[model samples]
Target chain A: MKSLIGWGVKPVDSHVNEKNDKAWTFKQKLFLGLTPGQYLGQALRNPFNWILGIIFAVGLPLIAYRYFFGLGAVTHASNDYPWGLFLGFGLFVMVPLSASGFMLGTTVEIFGRHDFEPIERLALLNGLLGYFFAVVYLLIDLGQPWRLPYPMFVSFGPAAVLFLVAWHVATYLSVQVAEVSVSFFEWIGWLGGKRFIRRIAIGLTVSGIILSTLHQGALGALFNYAPGKVHPLWYSPFQWIHFFCSSIPAGLCMVIVVSTIVKKTMAWRCDSNFSDNLDRCTLGLAKGASLALITYLVIKLIGIAHDNEWGYLATGWGAWFLLEMAVGVVLPIILFAYAIRHQVVKVARLGAMITVLGIALNRLNTALIAFNWQLYQEIPHIFEVIIAVTIFAIYIVVYRFILYRLPILYSWKAQPEEALAAEAVRPAPIRTTPSPAGAMYRKID
Target chain B: MSGISRRRFLAASVAGCAATTLAGPRKALASGTFSGYPDGMGVLVDLTRCVGCRSCEAACNKEQKLPAPDRPFDDMSVFDETFHDGKQKRRPDENAYTVVNRYNPEGGAPVYRKVQCNHCNEPACLSSCFVNAYTKTEEGAVVYNSKVCVGCRTCMVACPFHVPAYSYSSSLDPVIKKCIFCYDTRLKNGLPPACVDICPQEALTFGKRKDLIKIGHQRIETHPGRYVARLYGEKELGGTSWMYLAPVAFDQVGFDPTPGNEPIINNVKDFLGTVPMVLAIWPAMFTGFHLLAKKQKGHDDHEHDAEQQQGEDGGEQ
Candidate 1:
């Protein structure tokens, strides 16, 4: 892709190809205005594709084998350890990281922070795909994958914490899809749908906040069902709050981490707006993450204090818990504070990377590692690990595919035809002086 | 006293009272703490009387029509079966609904503890099920409807006793297999389960749950030296239908001793209670924030919608 960009082959970012007056067809957009040969050439040239290929080669068969032979064929999910990497990593970890959607939605839409606007679509897309794949991971983990909607449409156990998760995740996934659809609508040239989404954007963002709050907490509350099973160091009376609070930083840091990755790997796909605003956004997001990390740390301590679990802090597990706190929560706090103060986006980016890992470790520790601490530790079956990795790899591929084409990383410039049509309709002759974005489009056209 | 009168002396708690409080108490029985059904049948298993014979295991297998086990019920070596690096004793699995393991408590003769579903007043398995697959019946049996089971095994994760087992090998139709207390054929028919019917030594005594608690206390009182003072399931995790009279301390015989009397669902109620509040409060609160923030936007976002058009035009180059 970088090589193609260097070759002066521009990727599609508008309804029409700039050099030609003709509108870009759907096929042309899908291939990023490149011919089939050039598209294939880039895909095959990237070594990441080969790595994904190898993973799919091994993991796809195991996944099929699991469905054919049953979950026992691929997972070490026994009666005692019912959830393995599937729920521990795929659902628990992915869901929190994907919280980037709601956090950014709240900042940009709900809080009207236009400064954070540049990466809002990327964050929303990140949330949508992360959750979509989390559900994909869930389907693989569920015994009756076909009955995933049974809780919603069939039999509803409205009281169970999991029922809340099922309903919220399902609903939030819709909210996120609607939120991210602005970019999709722009790409597909569906101006009406984009306008409609814009009108109801507030409703969607509000609902996103409501659903994300309950469900992110609900995932933690699922562990509340097994109070005795989860080790006290990780367990808490406020487990849900701990989960909810930590997710704020997790979500913010995730945006920073993802934007950094985008800036590093796919700079060509990013327009000036995204590439230019990313550093400021990283620092701004780091500030939010630092505050969240501090809140999470204090509450984590309070959770232990409220439960009088200070005794467990001296044990090996306590040491491990402190390690998580020191690295995941505390270290990120210090680094973020320093980075924000110094305006060192590179340092903030490093802190964001650590915060993401810290959140993942926290969820994994609660869900799998420290779970059933009284019982012998169960290692997930090899096939289960491979399948989890494969699904994550697929998530990355889908994420890249969207970033490569969607008008998410760049402003979709108005076609010359649309600009002329707007000009013809506007009797006042551009009296509004078009917002910078509109002006950019007019200039390009 | 008759069983009905004995219920006044003790409560027959089978599931948490908190369970009904969250969802508008469709099964609300008189609204206070929901003890088990008044006439709910229960089993009092005297561990001193259990002879380590696996007859109950055999009877459960036959009654449930479960698949044959890896070892025959008559095989005493199955008693030595340990798993997960010998950290786990033989537990009920897809093939077996109950198993008797020999526990040699310190300074005591080998005590045999029959491990099965405690059939809690608020069974964690029943409470955690998202599909409403589990039902704590008026008969005091916590039964499952496998037709609706999603195979998430959340019940398995939620069961503090670690009782529910999954049949993960069945590709198209894996379901949780556990001791349902013979709810289908026997307990619902007002008869003792097959395990109780087949116990040779009367180690398993079946009667109304209140009567069983009374009888359990009487045995402890009448034979002070013969049993531990505590009834294993009484007030345990909001109490279980199947109570135990162990010869040694419960933990010495492989029971989780410190599991508090609060039902597992109580631990989750804090979170569930917040759901309604968040659903109700967040929309208004966040919308209010949006309005406040939008009010400060100074203009009705004449400053580029940003997502679609993030450029300020920066004085329009």
Candidate 2:
């Protein structure tokens, strides 16, 4: 019967119906319980929607063209560079960032670090959206997008590293979905569903850790097939270890980055538990990230040493490689250490941003830029770039959609006594008065 | 009780280690590298004897039932067709099963080299395919089944020769297109491929793989001045079925000389070895850590409880 706006703190009514009859209808909830005019005003006001509008204008048509004319229409379609930005960014960059799900799941459930409980759902949601969008990007890139499940039920090539990646990612996507569904159930006021998931939470988290570990590593191992193609500086025999280790920092830092964004943009959605514990969690994650960065740095150096490639550090590619390490790895490591020691959350946030960029650079280097070091570089087609950015924009829109309605950034407010009373009596006093802040909430609320 | 428990834990860990070691998945690597099927048919291309004729290309095009080229086979002007990168050389692609490129040496006469699937003893495309879409038949042809192809194009990345080309233009039935050594029609019947059979200059010599290696070496040995000392593909990428004795260095003739002797799959074995270990160990090990943390917490509180008991006993005394 009460408004959901600024009702972030509890002791609030659970339903948004005027007569307090039942919960808000699905359509009402979708519009955030706002009138159609208010929803349109909100959509028109935001600058980000305009950017998304332009992207879709160009990209959506190109995407349609791609399907009608084939991959050749949007991509350079060079046989020399079989993989372009679609797999390079979509699969490689996105998968590591999505590793946050398993990282937080292990911290809270397996290790009993309940201090991390507040942000656990956020990390899981970030992971789910990242992976879900990665698959979306893949769908755009695949020649036969419809036949994605052929490796699972129809055919088998168990010996390939990609086979391992295909199987593990498929399994892990389900694991992440199950892990995040608890929050979904709570938001929908399904207490029974939440309780059932809670019972299987540990098993799901364990499988998550297992699946995340293998697939993250397996992605790197995919490059092993091209021993001669990739630059030696980027390629290593221990590439799987490098990828897995880097993802640790990548995952932890992503949580910091997402939390910072949520705090800045939508602090109204955050409950005290999330908003209050966020700084402490940032520092905790920074510490974990620093440890991972150091491990990643060492293994990377060790990889070079193992291959007797110390001489490469002086070449042009080596300089480029060093730049990647300095910007993506070393700079973040220093910032994270300084931030953790000084208890400065902002520096940690900055480090997280840099770490994210660094991971993206690393994946792009491995999959595209530094790949085929001896051959001429292949630039992504303009439409390909537009389509990729457009897909990512859609990802952000879906992510924000869920964050607004779900119990991800905040706990669901469940007033059981009010619910019981509403059930017992009909035509009760409706608490539908909107707060002044609800005006802003009503539009983009 | 502590000592006995420690002994039991150690025994359990050892037994667990042994069980995993014994029950480990069959070694995908370390099963010994394949040396290609014995009596596998192969082609020995003697570059010194070949003229830059397009008969083999035309035969391959016709035998494979490929679509007509923009420039017909008789048009020598196609040789001057430069790609976007300005390299006039053409490699194999979806429409063409094989191509002959003319490499103009600085002083010597122009040398023409034919490029097709090398069909390595351990074909990277076959190993990297997750759908089992590729097969290296015992007859030395690396063939593909498009019905099972998922179109991931990992084979495109895996092929050191860059032989596999995807039909990205065909949305309805896009698949990899490459030379198959005429496996279904000729090689299966113990006859040479159409390209080898149609080489009027006798540039391509078809024979058993081992016999070809011997012939390649003998040619290089007898005609040392005419041919390069090394036979390309004999030890490259664990020995492809197609061996070449070029007049100039292999690199000069458009062959990649830097591919290490080991096959591409060998590079991935170390990571594959770790998969089972992580899959087997992570569950119990993490659960153990979880239980240990729980026990440590309980033990800390119990220690405090014991101290209180001790104080009560002291007061009673």
Candidate 3:
């Protein structure tokens, strides 16, 4: 009668029995079978939480102070450099990285790449958390956060590229919520809800593709509003294409990176199916990422050529630009290719980490560093950096909380006997009709 | 549900049509060449007569009723002000709508350039505002409505001249601060802005924009040695309501000599054009991919069954 629920997947009956398990409730499920004091102790003992504690100590007050005392209190508040790090990192960088939901949704659902099914839920969850947190970052940065709905309800500047970005991002957030909700429904044992979602799943995914395509490109086109202000090297008529194409690899590699982190740090949460096939999934994602990286590099070069910005390459900015390409784009391409050929997942993981860094660097450079190339660089204020890091920490906490509980990296257990029945009724070798995803919802004996 | 009531359906269709027609004209201006409204007012700034006096800045401050400056307007020492960026002289900010910066050319005398909103014909701030908070008035003023503004600061970034500043010190209510060409009080009443009216040396000329352009060229042609032949704002960013003629080259006096003739919005049209294409094509394209995958799965299932039968027969033999 000891708890079967520890740090791994918890089925419906894992904490519930006909006699005594009925006493265990949502509170027990939330606490992961540990007492409240034990949970607090476990959290405090982790060194990472201590670092987060220190960040929130300084940063939470700063955020409150920013609202009370105004943006000028914590920021240098230069009108010339209006965007700063809040947008450069949070909106611009995070949006592209969160493209994972649509990417994996397409791979597994649309393309019928069922090998990718194990990681699809994880990708969807990562995408949802990233976008939700990006909005949180935006609220901190906006001067009038309460009026965030102005673009949608009060007034419409349909001509503006930012107007497109605003509307699409809002709609896409809902799409991501619905897509990730399937896992949430499964975890909560709502078979009916999961089935309803599965029925409209194709409609949701197609809209996701449309929304992701427009908004990811729209973020780049926002810079087109500042023609001479952005450096010639970074600004192009094809800036939209550059952002959209690079996001493909960024999205794919982000999935690999998140899965790798989950496997290394919290293997107990992963079922054997996930742990066993993770290496193969990593290589498959790396193949997609390498193809995207190569396409991104060529399009970037084409952008430079179309603009005839070859002369800027001789300057210091051009050298920095080349270094970003070499490290972020070229090196990842070579390493991913090498890893795929040699079947070295460790090397592919390293490539993914570098790619994430590279994408972050590219967004920062375009938004802050290379902006106003003639003027001096705008170094983000100390408080601004702290708030950014704090928001990112909150993102990680929410991400981990969900991954630990949801049927993302592992399958959820149905009723005790039904779960066993499902195992017994696994699809025969020659039987293939409805997708595994659809078949997963079949009634078991 | 009974299909929408007939009255409701008719009302909805009428409202939809009305909205489309109302939005139609605005969409037309988002692309193509936009020379300003024909009767738009303009200012001609003759830099030779400015004489480094800060009267325009003082006049602007008084008219706008902005917060008092750290240094008094009469303080001549303000001419030597330096910004946090090591070399930048004061540009316009929240407190003052206009500023006069003294740019001293190497061997010549000091030239004072008064900086404020240029009131662009095709204003980037107006185009980039997602909330439609900015309006390019027929009076040739780029005006803002702070009530609808979400203050995302895209306007500040989009301004080529860096004219708009935000009231970042106001926690409860922060808004963009920029010169509106005194549209509500002065320009609409057929009177010049306070700064133009108070110019001691007739340095700032107020007239029709077309007339000012002709006047600007006449002065340059008449006194070629005293002026650079180029008029600063006539063709910059698709022309502006304010034009300047300076003795020194425009860059020496802090004007972007080559800001290009195309307006900022033109640079974004190509990307915007592709948006509808993507919306139209992606659904069909991806749905086709899904169908193809389903078809391939069917083919694979057939092969698997055939192979199983062949293996069963071989085992029996």
Best by the lDDT measure: 1
For residues A1-445, write the lDDT of model 1, one tens digit per residue: 8888889999998777878777899999999999999999999998989999999999999899999999998999888899999999999999999999999988887787777888888899989998999999999999999999898778867778888788778878877888888888778866556655665666677677777888899899899898888999888878888899988998888888888888888999887777777887889899888988998889988888888989999999999999999999899899998998898989999999999999999999999999999998979999999999999999999999999988888888654544545634322111222126422221111
Residues B1-317, candidate 3, lDDT per residue (tens digit)? Answer: 01222233234323322322333355556777789999999999989999867888889999999888998888989888787665577888899999998889979999999999999999999988999999988888899999999979999999999999999898989999999999988999999999999999999999999999999999989999999889999999989999999999998988888899988898788877776676657766876786677577865334423544443343346
User: What DockQ does model 2 achieve?
Assistant: 0.31
Question: Which of the two candidates, 1 or 3, achieves a greater lDDT against the reference?
Answer: 1
TM-score of chain A of each: 0.95, 0.90, 0.90
- Candidate 3 lDDT by residue in tens digits, A1-445: 0123444424332324334535346676576556677667667767888998888898889889889998887776589899988899999999989989999999876786777777888888878887898899889888999999998789999888888887788878887888888877656655445644554566677778878888899999999888878898888888888899888888888888899888877776777767877888899999999999999999989989898889999999999999999999999999999999999999999999999989989988999999988877788889989989889988988898887677687665453444333543432222223223323222111
Clashing pairs in 3: none
Give the runs in model 2 whose Cα sits over 4 Å from its true position: A1-22, A415-445, B1-30, B298-317
DockQ of each: 0.33, 0.31, 0.37
What is the DockQ (computed on Cα atoms) for candidate 1?
0.33
Chain B alone: TM-score in each candidate?
A: 0.85, 0.85, 0.86
Question: What tens-digit string does per-residue lDDT give for candidate 2 at B168-243?
Answer: 8886678899999999989999999999998988999999999998888888788889987998899889999998
* Model 1 / residue A162 / CA error / Å: 0.5
The 10-residue segment with the lowest total lDDT in model 2 chain B = B15-24
What interface root-mean-square deviation (Å) does model 2 yield?
A: 10.2
lDDT against true structure, model 1: 0.82
**Candidates ranked by TM-score, best first?**
1, 3, 2
Model 2 clashing residue pairs (backbone):
A1-A15, A441-A445
Q: After superposition, how far is residue B8 of candidate 2 from its true place, in Å?
A: 24
Preferred candidate (DockQ higher): 1 or 3? 3
